[model samples]
Target: MSARWAADLALGVRLALGGGGARTAWARLALTATGVGLGVVVLLSASSLPHMLAARADRSAARLPVAEAAGGVDPVFAAGRDDEFRGRGLQGYLVQPTGPHPPAAPGVDRLPGPGEAVLSPALAALLQSPEGALLRPRFSQRVIGTIGDTGLTGPNELYFYVGAADVAGQPMAQPVRGFGGEPARRGLDPLEVLLVVLGATTCLVPVFVFVVASTRLAAAARDRRLAAVRLVGADRAQVRRIAAGEALLGAFAGLVAGAGLFLLVRVLVPRITVSAFRGGIFAADVVPDWRLGGPVLLALPVLACAAAVFALRKVVIEPLGVVRRGTRVRRKLWWRLLPLAAGGALVIGRLGTEDARDPFVIAGVVLILVAVPVVLPWLVERVAGLLGGGSPAWLLAVRRLQLDSATAARLVSGIAVVLAGSIALQGVYARAEGDRPPPGNVRVLATAFATGVDGARAFTTALHALPGLAGVPVTTHALLQNAAGEKFSLAVQTCAELAVAGCRDGDVYTSDRLAPGAGLWSGGADRTRPPQWTIPVAGHHVTAQEGAALIVTPGALSTAPGLALSVNATIPAAGPDVVEQVRNLIGWHGRVSSLGTERDDTSALITRVLSVGSVLVLLFAAGSLLIAAWEQLRERRSTLAALMANGVGRGVLARSLQWQLAIPVAVAAVVAVLAGLGLDWLLLTLLVHRPMVADPVAIGILTATAAAAVLLVTAVTLPALWRTASLAHLREE
Candidate 1:
């Protein structure tokens, strides 16, 4: 290489290394790099799961079309009556005329004669048939061509085909209206949404943290160089370029490493699921979408450099007549720091105010993390002061903390922030989920109901006559079609009885549509059509059991031929006798369930998960704390020797160290409390239905753990500190 080219390369390497010296700076860089790498791995892996899920859903969905009726049959009923039809023995079907359909019985003309059915792939799986195969749990038909791939229905459902006779089996006998209504649509995939949020958080948050940590490290080093340069007659602009260049180089290298790791992770994720494929011939290979990979790769390095450049902007400018003895806080430039503090506060506020239901809440929280460093310095100073006293070792540690408050704040703040932020979020989630209204008391939903007005009236009267069941409202519902060709069901009960099912009901109950009472009115065109009315069902019914269809009045479905009218009861939490008494009156065939059981099961699962996650996080924190603490301990050898010479006891010295550390953690607890409250507000206002009830026990455990760690670290260090102190006395010989 030419001399000039070699010099340029040398300069680039020097810039990248900054003034921390290549070897030492490299170690810090490596740690930061590791964090970045881990973040990328999590981002690439977890984020990619959703795409895989969607693809799986699509592949599964491919065999099924949106459940629909033949052109000759009313599509309106087909679309609106999926739940009703499914319950009445209609199965899921794929969209293809060539597919097999369910066989008809000897007298059932509406059933497919030989080989036709309409069913989703899920149904097919249950029946052990290929897509578009006829379901003959009772009979048989020849398997025909399968349904063509379409991205309309949910995965792995049964799909069948049938001619005009298919609609005849429907209990409803209303004359078929023209084919028109809401198309069968898939709801947003919760898994996909989770993946997207996880991906975005992993990618963006890690990168942000990596850049912030790296930038802070880089800028600190550069400032030392800049200070030296100012003494040597370098101009501000010249100093700034050198600092900027160094930062840019470090960032570029980190980004390159990060991207390489990111790509490797992306390639490896398909393999995680590959093990599950188990001898399948269809190889599950995802062509890495460069559409995604390319942008991430290109943007990461650029982002790294930009982050470095931004961080260094302040330290590059030299203050006039500034000395390096004390921390430099240029009075003239104090206003600049306000922006940083303000920026952090704004981010925190935004996250706090966000609708927790939105996935963006994750992003906001990650962004708010930047505020950690801004707040950490003040905390460290207070904490370090609390650990005072001069047994040589203790004095040394204190002096060190006092001397480089900036660096201490920068390094330790990340750890503190990780600890605090995690605690705050988890604390809030635990509280909110735990304190949520009991499923029975909060929702007042009926778990089981009988069909038909007569059944509902009799059921209501029977239950009301029983002692202790007077308040129980048996919500009645009807299924019907509107003039618009829309199908609906009503959940009807007296307004006072709405809470009996765990929901608030107006005099006219309707579906939960936001439009003012549209939930109440139904089935009519302009002035000519007859008004269709349906009652609304709420509480446990809406929250849990109303999965397939809306709760409605018995009169609604009565108009449909062969339709069964049922009254469903929202049972509250009570003794077995109370439950059985109601059940005896309704008969054995009535619908029966308790939403509280479902809620309790769900809550138990969440508790287990949170407990597991907290353990893992604590382990990570403890390990990191030990390593960092040990490193600090090693650096205090000279001070320890001095303290030992003065005859300071090892026990006292250990207590001092413990005291200092405890101060910061105590501060962190306060921060956690504030953050927890903020989180509770966010959850109550934006995410959940009730005020959060933080588990005092869980919080106590966490507090105890943190306290125990402080004491344990102190206890553990005493032997070592004593050994070192004793060695110092031996050195005196």
Candidate 2:
């Protein structure tokens, strides 16, 4: 901590980094810095996402003015339209501003006047296109300005903001409140948070592993240098300080490079939009917050230094030579199973409980993922020890792995995690898609919205006219004025339909006062008082109260003043095209959607996200594995040269390298696949009780990809191995 000591440490760091004019040493240092820098970049980018997304949401919310104060109540009027624009369906909003637009809102130059609208930049660009002109007339509005990062539209979606007066005479079926002063919420939901965590974990895990692995790159050379320093009258503390200083220097350089990379990426993020709920995130939202980013940058160096210190733990700096102290206590295989056992127990326990949150399940899965690497070293050590004697190449590779199982395990850890994630995601996707009804048997529930008794009859007639349609049930509701002239909505459906729809006691009613052929009436009478008549439908014996008279048939619909007509029909053998046609036909009158469409859409989105994450993780993992392999080969050059001098063929050495890489990878792949499937089963059992389905194709692809990556990395490093095995390397040694 003294000034003299600090100056000495600085001198040592400079000498270590300068590499005493050795180009190979400088190159190793540069590669280490590059690895650390890349890791830092990914970490910072992932950390910034939530903040960026929230900022976009805030900007969009700010576009709307505060709600007007209506005496004691705040009056907020809003309208939305679901229409196709530029060949894409979008939900558009119109808000009644109580005051002028806020200047702080992004992309709004001024408040939109009646018949004038503010379009998102994407929508504006589309509207200005020649193809967009053909659709412009239908919107009947002038685009006054463009909004950027509104957060209400996707990259391909069309979203426009207009004044409430533009939609004054139009019916606003759905009301949007809470758009006033501050947006009620600004953050990710539970599922979104889970996904973000999952993505970040997947991305940054490999980066961290690479960074740690990078510190140990050329470990033999580092140990020799430290040993020389010890022989020159330096104590253990001084040697450790010098080594830490070297790591810190590389890490600091990496942090700077990473910061530069992040800034460059920030500029490009605005151009790339990823779709999710509330539209997708814009580039502007992805800019790293310095508060969070600063810590991440600072942590990288600390972690690098710590890893360096840890790697040096077994290395003893003696005057004679560097002695790596080997552990007397061998790691037991059962110790590795503890995490998996605990995680499985947690998952099983959670399944017995009702309303378990997703985070708990994610935690359980994470535990299982963590166990893969934990158990790998022991497994590799045991496997390599058992399979030590085969061909000369096999014996050489196995003995090398057995000698340093920890390093062998580290090489394939990334691939293990990625493989496990892919398998688990495949299981989840299978379970989700399994619930989807088969084609031709997919039920289509068509709902038609119309007004008046005549409209109900017309809608029903149109529904029945469709070929291959069945269960053409129609329900009509009226807004009735009571004796006090107070109006309330009442649904008119027969007792049979009400029973089938699972209406509760107070939710359904029948009356003897009604004509024999009339349908049942509900929800207009006071719940505190009894009605004049109470009767049950033909099938159920439980119904007691008759709030109002029934109008059983469409012929009796005209007796009451009908407010809205809801006609339901089912198409059992409809194809997607036929279903689309039905939807379009019903949409001509009102909003229409088939049953389970929303659920299916959500499941598909989740599947896509998981699949993408798995692919990215695999790519990153492969890159890390390649870097580790190259570094390992470089460190083992002297050993390889010695082997070559002892009559070992280049081909045998090459095969040995491949086997060394392959042994850990093959073991990790099997463990990962099994762990992945188990995790998937636990997740599904806890969430939804769907049957377990193994995806052999996905498993095969994952295995083949991991194997191919190992082979490719080995092939790429073979030239390095050949050079290391030559007389030049032996003479240098």
Candidate 3:
């Protein structure tokens, strides 16, 4: 053991300063540092996200105050609290007031007797008051008091606070009452999930960086007079220990750099958001938690060492003479390219057929990711050959990509992943950009109101007369229970009977167990408690028991008892010209909304997210590309030196080097486009199981962008490549 340790230590000391191993060690450290820094950034960000989410959830839950309830209350209420509050819950209150001025808005000067409640900030804002006070209407002395924010009873609503007592007298839950449904109650926040995904992905970087550097260094050591060590009684194990130890040292240095970067990002996120809620810098508090940090710190080094150890085994088993020539994957090119083709097909098909705006974009991203490794080698070879034209230095530099396909693949793989992620995100954003509202939606919403039947007919007449207008009115309605358990109005539009062209379906469906067109009356086993009523909506009916109703058309509702119906028109294909004409014809009598508005909003949000995500991906990709280029240049330095000795000009050599990098990037871009199509197809499949309705224009744009990226990368590397190819000083050295 002592002999082995001494031998390993000596090798380790020599590797730290000897020939190429010394440079390789430093290079490995640099590469690992980048990866570790990314990992740490992702780690801190991801950890804080979940902690922040939980904290926010807890805070919001606390503010509700109903979790404090201890004794028996309504069975439903008790059941709801069971999950959130393990022990005693908050006391629930119901205060009904009989006072003079019923609560109109916030802040009222002394109601008749018991004061009013401060319900929600939204209510306060709506009422144009400060404290949400209500003067009991027609009653001499009675009032309810309350606090906190609650949301109105509706889909996609903001939070508002409402007390049972505050709305006890109202016919329905004060316009917005939801005791059971809230956004908070939904699983985890999506943003938190995104952070986790980022962290998990970044963790693999150090492993790759360490493995590649170690492999290269180990190969070099054999040729540089280190081969006799094993013959001189130094076993493979000792050699491996030395190599792995060097990797460990590099990993530790990287960890420090990574930790510092994580801290910086942590500080930045809060400043960007600027709110009362400060996210955990390390998880749930100001102080760092080892439960999270320990895992990170320990995991990074372990991953690095494990990667090094695995690569070291390859270094050990091989005979020194052959291994000195360098390692290679003895596989056919066709075998590799086949996977690339399959992946490309999937990616291209997806990008071609699906809505770029769908979450399915992520799937397309994955396909592109899978295809990259298969395509990279050939791409590098082709690009390098092209760059090698007429330039000896560039020709030599280009051989690095040609002769060592695996190394090139390794170097380029990171860039491929980065590019895939960015393009997928960008596709999402671009589609969104086309759909963004023209600043008119928000302003128009305030002036517009749902139209009555006659009002709709009148508006439709004017709309049809408008220039560029060509569509019939599409109006639908729904019967839904109000917060106070009273059935009232609900409605939506079905423009052109197409889902995407600005048409939404109301949430009204027949209960499969119940018969169609059956009226719900309070009675039998399932029907005993306000038995639901099923009514015919249009030609095709929805089953809604008496109390539980479904959607209907404005025309259909006209026949229903005590039902006042309204009509709305939708122009799915309408443009600015038609919109303006319709506006003039309608003369401000009814509300006008373009389906485009919603699409535009969705697009804007998608763009923001894609932009941020793409930037990070680009950074990672660029770094990988640079590392690959640098290593390639270094590995083939001798070849370039020979060319310099042969009187090959540095300029030509640089061009060749540029071509090598450029060609592979271009090839990857092409493969990416093909993969993008598969991505589009996958999305289209999700939209409709049958044949796709592909967007040719979108395909064209995607292809163009990918091609452009390849060109851009090539342009950026040309000058530096030329300089590297010029072996004037290298030859002398």
Q: Tell me which of candidates 1 and 2 scores higher on TM-score.
A: 2
For each candidate, give its TM-score against the true structure: 0.49, 0.71, 0.52
Model 1 Cα lDDT, one tens digit per residue, 439-496? 5472223333343455557667877787776877555554555444566654555435
Worst 10 residues of 1 by lDDT: 79-88
How big is the positional error of residue 689 in model 2, measured in Å on the Cα after superposition? 11
Better of 1 and 3 by lDDT: 1
- For candidate 3, the per-residue lDDT at 640 reads 70
Off by over 4 Å in 3: 1-14, 17-28, 43-49, 56-233, 273-330, 333-371, 378-400, 421-443, 447-611, 634-650, 679-733
Candidate 2 vs 3: which has more TM-score: 2
Estimate the lDDT of model 3. Answer: 0.43
List residue ranges in candidate 2 displaced over 4 A.
1-8, 59-67, 70-78, 82-89, 94-118, 124-144, 150-157, 162-207, 273-278, 287-297, 325-371, 388-396, 420-589, 600-615, 638-655, 673-733
lDDT of 1: 0.45
Using TM-score as the yardstick, the better of models 1 and 3 is 3
Please give, for residues 1-733, the per-residue lDDT of candidate 2 as tens digits.
6875576567457756665346777777777777677777777876785586567557646645444433433333456555443224555566454444322234456556557778776677766787665455434577777765544534444677666452322244322333335645534433333344444455556676677777777677777777777787878877777777778877877787777877887776545444433355555566677787778677777788788888877788886788766555477777789889887877677775423355565566677788888898888887877884789999899889878888989999878877776676666566556656644544555656565557767777777676655454555654433334344334556545555565433233434333232232222433344322232233222333344333333333444443444555655646554555565556434444445444533344454555555665676677767777877877777788889889999999999999999999989988888888787677666545557778798789878987898788888888878877785666543
